[model samples]
Target chain A: MDAVRPVFYVSDGTGITAETIGHSLLTQFSGSRFQTDRLPFVDTPDRARDAANRIRAAGEAARTRPIVVTSCVDGSLTALVAESGALMLDVFAPFIEPLERELGEARQQRVGQAHGIVDFDTYHRRINAMNYALTHDDGISMNYDEADLILVGVSRAGKTPTCVYLALHHGIRAANYPLTPDDLEEERLPAKLRQHRNKLFGLTIDPIRLHQIRQERRANSRYAQLDTCKREVAQAEAMLRREGIEMLSTTHASIEEISSRVLEHLGINREMY
Target chain B: MDAVRPVFYVSDGTGITAETIGHSLLTQFSGSRFQTDRLPFVDTPDRARDAANRIRAAGEAARTRPIVVTSCVDGSLTALVAESGALMLDVFAPFIEPLERELGEARQQRVGQAHGIVDFDTYHRRINAMNYALTHDDGISMNYDEADLILVGVSRAGKTPTCVYLALHHGIRAANYPLTPDDLEEERLPAKLRQHRNKLFGLTIDPIRLHQIRQERRANSRYAQLDTCKREVAQAEAMLRREGIEMLSTTHASIEEISSRVLEHLGINREMY
Candidate 1:
């Protein structure tokens, strides 16, 4: 069994930024197991001290120094965490000084600004894009005119989640349309989709994976059969190639990967959120 | 106007993780302007050299060392990036050595494992949660039995997006139901929601903000009126208080913040994705 180590994500705010960066880095090490704790809203000096004590306790209990990944912007709070005798990786400390020098501006050292809702315009744009994605999901609404990208795929080919991710993360108005059996039987893109073919991006997956996914949704059904999935995927791939649309396989790609590929293939520049 | 500094997010894979961490760090410096470029799939030494050249060019043009935040796990690739003559903050490099020593094991040094589809169970859970959120959005489906959480809020109070975020990021099965005018007028919890009161959470927002959001959705409608928004918000707050359910205001909260608060308040531990 892999040894378990205590991993702490500490932040003066919600700890999400720390958690995101920490988790991504941790995933690279497949040898060990991590027992994680998130300490959020540790803004005050008292809270910072308390978090440090907790880290010390965790290290003592595990008989190994706990790893702390922190995004605390306050200098004093970050120093307090560093004194906990753990291996501390400060996400902000390494970059802030250089940024200050490069920009010729002092750091604000404001708590929660990194993940807060200070920018209402960007927040609203993300919300609006999400609403757009929901309303236009599965071709329920024909509003492709407003979409920055329209994702098309067979059922369970990862269209909906990718659209939601694009909207939520990049504020991209993404609409997803599922290619139905009827459309696949004809081996042609639907009329409404053809008109917006310029913005069309296709997602394909292995038939076996699609079969397993469908089985989970509806067991012992014709739709969950391997043969059905194979036929549908074949037709979808042909349609994507025939229409000269960029296609990606979701069989081993994360939604983040799919969204990135879609954006890169479309040559869309993402607005900073 | 703030002078723009060139910023680069480089990674061995999609660059989304690097961009996420880099963007969060950069948000701390509100005084400076940034022109960002993302270079993904820089897995090989040759690609790393090319990426370094681009960074050097950006730095030369901007008359400042371009800031490069990278998540490259390969040693040679990271070394090549550090030689770019840019201010590089390697997200993975700073922690990997300590983590390796702590675990008493060597890293596999694999590229793109951090954001890949290697874990099918986790990937499926996220997809399942997303589908659940979509099906149960706005009380469209009353199958709250399987919901880990059910969010109740007025229309445009950011219930849908928050639920989707929780589902996508944490693999939490969240369902959101909109509070209608009729329920608010009655000043009572709906019959269907009464049994699941323990799992219910309320979302409220400032009437002015609600009005602005509604105006964008439907201009010149009674639903977008300030008076109407005020009445609905007041009623919603009172109803939440009467029902003894915890509530959070979404007026100035991001989806990440809202989800974190909801999970924290409900004593829910998120399954790390």
Candidate 2:
């Protein structure tokens, strides 16, 4: 207990979570005697070595055991930890087993619920927004002019996350309208959004991926079927193209990339995260 | 090439960077179709599984290969990747090597710049802060009233990162002042902060850990010696106690712990990340 040592947390990307959790655990150990040196934003290889060397130096100077907690998207710190010869804890490695169990259960549950279902979570959130819009009408009509961007997507397209991410990270206000069967039959943009065609961005995903994402929330539902997901995505993309509004296929892109691409399209020079 | 699937990114934390890079990579693969899912605040094990299950389901539904790009502090998706049998690319793993090299060079260069220079980056940041404070005195004055807490420590203590983390994560503004030898001799708190004694928090680290962190930054300098580090930390702590301010030793605690504990001491509720 008297031989207290320095603890290290090396995060590969954001370093926010690993750092946060490491701090939590270290607090448990130190009670009143804990101390740490956090090195955040080590996204590049040079930065990881810097963190490793810092750990090594810290170890050499310690009269006791030194602990290093690292969080990275890649296993780049393996060598750094091996070289440092300190007590190393990789925060990410421990969660894999738990995640497996949790996912396994989710898979089984979805398989059981495969009939006549609706994605209530998604439904609820969208409904919540509609309710907000309805209540906040304030005679301040839902003008496309007030929207920074309008998202047109088929049901279960990756519109919600992108919208939320855009709003939260860049402060770009976005309104999303699902291209329901009614909208598709009408063969026109959402009536509320036709006025803001210039600000519209479309999101389309691979049918299969959309089905899987949908199934996880409500298994065995018509919405989770591959054919349904596929048809809706294709029709939605076609509609977007027909409307001549810009569209992004989100079948295999990442949120960062989509947001970046969106920002690029919108010509917005803002850091999203 | 025909069998190649579109790329995808799944993030359990902030999905900003993952999406950005994922999109770029998808474009490089010449696959115009890509997908993204941003799952933020995946703190619990169950939430992690839910995220993984969504990925697996997405893969099963895909007509092509499922290339997954993901980042998580808890490694929840490592099992997901292994079980989903997807081609997983951890973007953050490759950075440590480069970081190691840069830090080694820095240690060599800064070996004699200070006494016991642990946490070289931290030292540099603080020095930068001091420099900035010297010039930008009018910018965001961390008010004594609004500060969630204040930190008192000797030079080289881990005050800056802890404060910064608190500010960024919890919106708790933290202010820190170094207890100098002059203040010890005067037997009083720094005159600038006497009025804010109620909000003061103190930080101390073990001399050995302090020495090690210093040596990493300053290699063989006399100031990097354990004894000197100990003396300063002890003297600074003693002065803090004499002023009747409560202190936490950062000897074995992580930053998250320090911030939370400080918040707890101040009777503040910490926001969930």
lDDT for A70 in candidate 1 is 92
lDDT of 2 by residue, A77-99 (tens): 54555467666666545433433
Off by over 4 Å in 1: A1-3, A60-63, A82-85, B60-63, B82-84
Clashes of each: 0, 52
Q: The CA-based lDDT of model 2 is what?
A: 0.55
When only the first chain is scored, the TM-scores of the models are 0.95, 0.53
Q: Give one digit per residue, the lDDT tens place, for model 1 in A34-104.
A: 88888888888898999999999988888777899998888799888877888888877767777778768
Name the runs in model 2 displaced over 4 angstroms: A1-143, A271-273, B1-273
Top-DockQ structure, candidate number: 1
- Per candidate, chain B TM-score? 0.95, 0.51
Q: On a 0 to 1 DockQ scale, where is model 1?
A: 0.62
